[model samples]
Target: MTVHLPILEAFVKLGNYLTDFCENSYEKPSDTHSKFEMVITQAQHQNGWFTRENILFALKQWGDLLTEEHLTAWLSEYTLKYEESPKTIGIVMAGNIPMVGFHDFLCVLCSGNKVLAKLSSNDKVLLPFLAQYLIKQEPLLAERIEFTEGKLEGFDAVIATGSNNTSRYFEYYFGKKPNIIRKNRNSVAVLAGDETQEELQALGEDIFRYYGLGCRNVSKIYVPSDYDFEPFFTAIFKFSDIINQHKYANNYDYNKAVYLMSNFQIRDNGFLILKEDEGFVSPIAALFYSYYESEEALRKYLTENELQIQCVVSKQKNTDDVPFGETQKPNLNDYADGVDTLEFLLEL
Candidate 1:
């Protein structure tokens, strides 16, 4: 078998293992259960925001997406012609959510390139564990992946994910190389106020998942002017336990106090705050909302701020918006910032 086939097969096994791992914390004596548990505990200790449930949610999402069928379907869209001499693609991963950069790593390997990964300090453990799992399954892949603690060097191209401010530095430093430098982007939901209680409740997951840290997490919603927040708030009560998390609670207290002191008119449901703001990014524990007079207004604003937005969630039969609550469950093809990583790797 070719090297790529073993890698793909290994990932498929890893996905199956992860699905079983999340469904049941099986204490197989020889398995990596103890190490995985340590990594989860360390992740939460290093970053208060990285809760065990959130990390597992991310893991399950990946497990579902990393199937053979999904990989084949995503790769079918491209003619994955690799460089004669495989290029080194440096990936500066984001620490916002667990395994946020795994897709890029997978894409690099799928495109027959090498990965030079510089992990974020906050999310250092899990990806390495997965990589080790892959290499153990397919020893040939051990040569294709490398981790660097110091500065990234000898890379032909780079894929970096960071805030908008850090992107400037990335561009200045990696300008000469073929690179994908991702910046801040937020997701939004368009609610027509007539959605079913189920749909509205799912929207709550989009907002509350990962404490709204991911770019795919819905940070804001656009609703009709006469939208009644009572139904919306009621539907989201299922996620009320989120505030019990001390980090989330701290943000809620801090932002709520700031809003109250500033005399800003805000709606609260004991745990979450809803404020009227025209911004895409909202503070943790608070979601910004804007009253849309018409679909045309929302379209115009979206066009003007296209780069700042990630995915749009709505029930309308529109291609632009994702179904409610599925923002975080992106397929392999849902490239970040709409940039196709596989295509870039092929070109390189």
Candidate 2:
């Protein structure tokens, strides 16, 4: 069977609804939008990290990308061959960021596969609510999507996302099936020491958005040995209010105390902590930094460690570098862990 056009249309309508609702351009009051607001509230209540701002940001990004033109362009690259009986794709979602696994969900559906989604408990509210909206738009979608709180069974293929530790377990469990298992990866920014204040400010968005809890967030930076952080600090001062959130402040205080007790040198503003560490993943409210002697050596290091990195935030776009502030706003084709999810689904 060919890919279903109604499924595509349903998602486009969902994209329009999300855009209008987020932009406050909805022509009139409707139950869907009202209930969507409630779902956002419920999501935040379920997960403290799912703050209203972050959820809205995720929604708006999806809205902007889910347009007909963007979807068409994205799908044009794929030969969306479908089986006579759609394969049931079991997706194990991660909850670090709101609707983080939505791209996999989209891939499964658009490739004419059934989705048996196992939502992370922390992110249970948003996708199911959106799924209901999509089902409302096209009733055919109701049969294609399934949510399960129990162990996922009766699926032909699997996609799972988790930390490095849990990935071992996923491999053991889902290894027999056709699977795409993602492990922990963090993004890093390569700073040339000549970035403008505006670029640094935009880098702050890459760092602070989602409270540094996302894989695409710049948890680490590669800076010149003589780099001055004063300008970077000054540019990111506008985001200082992030400390007002209790959860973030608690993490800030805790990590600061730990570093201080260990007598490690750390750079601290009132809100953000910068530690000169050669690690990729940083704790919430903290950033890790490493000194780079030359661009050639840094490029070599990045190429060698590409598997551990999700994105490379830079002033210039390389094949894999995401622009400073656009890490979280990934295009539909920006598959996680550099895996082509749509192609995987179609092959299944």
Candidate 3:
């Protein structure tokens, strides 16, 4: 007799397990706890950006999000069907931050499709470990999840994430196959000058988390023409210790020197540099800012350049605007590139 497993329920259990592990791993150590600690160290060694704190933060965020209530509410919008013979989906993941490709991995499995993932070398450690936990919870997943080191073959569809240049290559190669190809995108914030110290402090989280590597990290800001930088700088001072990380410090020194040599007028707060630029993507340790004449003008600018923006962080909680520091803490339904991964997988 075949044993039937409820995949969704397994995930819910995994969520609870992770939450407990994160909260009480040290207090009640076990073999699994030791393994988690080991993997975190390994991840840090593999990618310097994947510090223990950042990895833990990512895990806790997912743990908090994967509860039954959140899962049910998110899945309720879609009509889900498990196929008798599911399609093999190849995913090209990005390595900008830890577990960046997990949502895609989750979507493929949740839609009852097979995932053949090409893990970025920088982030090759965490997901596979989590995959092992999932497979242990629901043995059937052992057949559904795969990690590939070589070129992806025998895949029915593709989902690739990369820089703009690599995206062109992805399109050329996977053009014939049904695919979701994502390119470089960055998030921006709109400052109205009246933001409270607490709000600005939270906004610092949106900027410095993952050392400003992820697409969701706010890389640019729009401020009123007469905006003052004193309060903004003071509020974000809590994150000043980020410069102690050698990798980030090097980038900070290098970028600051380059800016000074270029004779660009930039506002510096010893750790972070803010430059006036029209671009959305900014270098590490440097934030691009532009002066807007008015809120209406800023909205118009954002509307015209929506393609280059992953999210817009502002006090205003409009349909499109993400509130203050919430950009990096996206929900399960907040699809990247505004494309629905679950819907795409279901159609396949």
Candidate 4:
């Protein structure tokens, strides 16, 4: 079945509502002065409540890509060509960042699925508000979307996201049903010494956005041996203002201290560290490091470890090319980890 015009209009309306809400109502630097203050106030001294600034930043970043034309094209492509419809999809959301579930929610809705979304307590408010706005714009959506704190059953399939630790539990629990269990996967960047200062600055957004909490955050850097760190440092130093935020500062201070006390040798260029390691994923506020003797060696390592990687961002394009800053901001056609979710739904 083709996606109806009204449903596509509703998505566009929801996008507009989010954009207006962020620009007008959400806290801005001009209004709040400090994001830390807004975070503390919103959390009521409770830990893990996302700040208004961070939420707004993420929403606006996503809003720019979720244009009316983009939504319409995606709906038409998936529904018309793929033949996925009326799917009962249960979504298990991640709580590490604000509105992390929005993409999955859009996928289910665009695939003509009934979404049984189990929201993370950390992100319960924003998604429901957005869903309500969409429902208001087109009341028919109210019947298709459901939010609940309870366990999900009676769904035809599941799309579950969780940490590596919890992924095992998710697989065990939902393995009986048709599911795509997303385990912890980190995004990485391959920095050839020749990157322009302009490119390095844009890469900083991928590193610092959401305080390096999201999985799409580039937690590891593969740089050539004997590369000058000065230019890279100069490019990312603009984010020094992130130190002013108390939570991120605390994390930085804590991690720096731990590195000092443990006597773990590290390569620091002031704002962030580049430690030599093998793993792709690193802790938030911390990054892993690897040095390559040559591009061939790096390609060999990446090829050998293909199963362990999710997405790779690089300047040289042979294949598997995604734009630099676009790692975290996935477009409608960019299926997660290159898995065709719509195809899976159709088979079910």
Predictions in order: lDDT: 0.89, 0.91, 0.90, 0.74
lDDT of 4: 0.74
Q: Which regions of candidate 4 fall more than 4 Å away from where they truly are?
A: 24-49, 81-85
Ranking by lDDT: 2, 3, 1, 4
RMSD of 2: 1.5
Q: Which has the higher lDDT value, candidate number 2 or candidate number 4?
A: 2
Poorly placed runs, candidate 3 (over 4 Å): 1-5
Summed over model 3, clashes come to 0
- The residue-by-residue lDDT of candidate 1 on 1-348, one tens digit each, is 123566778889899878878877755533577788888898889888898999999999988987888877777787765444788999999999998999999999988899999999989989999899999898977888999999999999999999999999999999999999999999998888899989999999899899999999999899998989999988999999998999899999999999999999999999999999999999999999999899888888898898999998999774778999899899898999999888888887
Residue pair clashes in candidate 4: none
Q: 128-236, model 3: which lDDT tens digit per residue?
A: 9989998898898899999999998999999999999999999998989999999999999999999999999989999999999999999999999999999999999
lDDT of candidate 4 at residue 78, scale 0 to 100:
52
Q: After superposition, how far is residue 153 of candidate 4 from its true place, in Å?
A: 2.1
Name the better of 1 and 2 by TM-score: 2
lDDT of 2 at 94: 98
For candidate 2, give the lDDT: 0.91
- lDDT, model 2, position 41: 89
Lowest summed lDDT window (length 10), candidate 1 = 24-33
Better model by TM-score: candidate 1 vs candidate 3: 3
